[model samples]
Target: MAKKTVEAALKVEKLKVEITKLKETKKNIDQKNKQLKKLKKKETKTKKSKVEKIEKKKTKKKKVTQLTERKTKEAKEKEKQKAKEAKEKEKQKAKEAREKEKQKAKEAREKEKQKAKEAREKAKEAKEKAERTLEEELQEQLSPEEIEGFQIEKVNMEKLTNKVCVILAEKETTGMIQSELWKKLKLSSRDGSRLALKLERMGTITREKILEKGRWTYKLIIKKTPISTESIENAPCLTCPVEQKCTLEGEVSPRTCEWIEDWVTIEIKKPKTAQ
Candidate 1:
């Protein structure tokens, strides 16, 4: 019985040892499984994060393209509006210019009409004056000698009158005379004398008296004619007798007469019989 009991105790000790070894092996297998599962879960999470980042990048690219396209459209529209405004402004300016040109043309036409009317009135008045002068000349009666010697012609009347007046100015008391004025004028003595007397009566000439060799002589007087300021300033001083005395200082000086007179005497003698 003692031997059997010892054997039984040995058998119980062996069983206990076997059970502890099996528990250690089982714990090591479970730890290995847990490590593998953790590794798998981490890989899956990393892949998901990478996919999300790619999607975000694609969305940003799409938004940038849309913004750029919108900006381009706005720029094109602004340019079109600017071009339209410019065209409108140019059209308005052209219209105003045309209107101004039309107004100017109308004013020019009115001014031309006024000028034509004035010219016609002047022509009519000149014609009437010429007719009256012709009638008066035809009504006058002339002597045979006068008619033979005197004939009026359309000529420079002012020049002829000046020449005759200059010649007669040397003789009468007023230092002026119209003697033979009609003969010089190539007109009838009656008509010429009438005109010359009219000029004298109008105060164009006068009479004066001078003593010559103890006798009183009658002379004609011609009033001085005024010269234009431009002529006085531009006239040459070389021919003046008092040029040396005149100076540019102080007041303006008087100038000598520009014209001088000359006279000649004539005698008529009876013809002598041949000896």
Candidate 2:
């Protein structure tokens, strides 16, 4: 009975020791569980931060790509606008050029019309002037008898002819109009017109058709002056005793007259005097 009680006490002690060891093991397991839980929490926080950073990067890249596309679109639009403006400017320039050409052509046509009008007027004036002269018209209205009977009264023909020559000489080669000559000579138009015609017919004056005081008229120019009386002062016919009987085909002919021959010879030998 004593051995059995000792054995039982030993057994109780072993059991107590086993209980203490179990309590220590339980504490160690609790501590390990706490550490594992803290590490898991830290790992979860790191993963969340990485995910947020990746999201931010993706958003930034998207914004950058959108900005690049927008800028490229804007550039393309600007280029299109520039090209449109250039085309419009070119069209405007062409329109202006066409307008300028049209204006030039119009002005040229107007100038040509004005030139043609002026030419027509000039031709009309020339045709009227060429129709007839005043002196010719005056003579055509007179009869042959009236023209033959026309003479200046109280005027010596030789003196009158010499005075007309002197006046014409003063006017040089340009000559004087018939109206101005008649006024200076104090002669009537009727007599003056007849005298001018007679002088022109006699080969002592020439008549040129001209426009004077807006009328067709004559310009008289001296062709030859009248023979001076002094030129015949020593002529034998004036003093010859047979002057009445002397004729070109008579018995007392000038062709066989010795005195006339001698007088002609002497006049030919004399030096000519200037008028």
Candidate 3:
């Protein structure tokens, strides 16, 4: 019995030791579980912060796009207004130019009308002066003895004054003398008028009369006497074929006569020449 009690006590001691080791192992497993739960919580917090950052960036970009669109619209509106104002200015300038041209044309027409009126007045004054001269010459009557004496005087004068009167009366400037002198002179072709015969003998005067359809017209010329001493001194001693070298020919020879039948007596004051 003593041997059996001893074996039982030993077995009980070994069982107590095994129970203590099992308890220590269970405590280690609980500590590992707590560490895993702490790691999962940290990972969830990091992911949530990254999503919030991406949303904030998207909102900022949208606001910037709206501001850019507003600026572009305002710029286009300003450009349109500038173009409209430029077109209106061009139209106003064209209108002013047209009005100025019209005013210039009106002034030119008025100037032309004034010039026409002045020319008409000058023509009327010229006609009235010619009529008065014709009336004065018609008042004198001629006697047969006086006619004979008058014929002699007419021939001796440098030129035939009556023939000159008839030529002057036919010109446009002296047209007023036509009605007065044209009726009194008998239109004849005979070369033997007492006035013409006396003029032929004098040798100083030349007369040519033309009769056309019962009307008589006359041309009278005067012979010019040159200074003979001056002619001889200026003459060329040598003979030349050229007419310009022969100065003596023009001075000595008879000149081509000009008809001076009715020269108007116009008295003009001589201009003073420097001494």
**What are the TM-scores, per candidate, against the unseen true structure?**
0.32, 0.39, 0.27
lDDT of each candidate versus the true structure: 0.53, 0.80, 0.44
Instruction: Give me the runs in candidate 1 sitting further than 4 Å from their true place.
Output: 1-48, 51-55, 93-275
lDDT of 1 at 242: 64
- Candidate 3's displacement at residue 113, Å, is 8.9
Clash totals, every prediction: 15, 0, 3
Question: Where is model 1 poorest over a 10-residue stretch in terms of lDDT?
Answer: 259-268
Residues 6-80 of candidate 1: C-alpha lDDT, one tens digit per residue: 887777777677667777777777777777777777777777777777777777777887788888888888888
Compute the lDDT of residue 104 as modeled in candidate 1: 86
Tell me the spans in candidate 3 whose CA falls farther than 4 Å from its real position. Answer: 1-65, 68-176, 186-275
In terms of lDDT, the poorest run of 10 residues in model 3 is: 259-268
Tens-place lDDT per residue, model 2, 43-90, is: 777777788788888888888889988988999898999889899989
| Order by TM-score, highest first | 2, 1, 3
True-structure lDDT of candidate 3: 0.44
Best by lDDT: 2
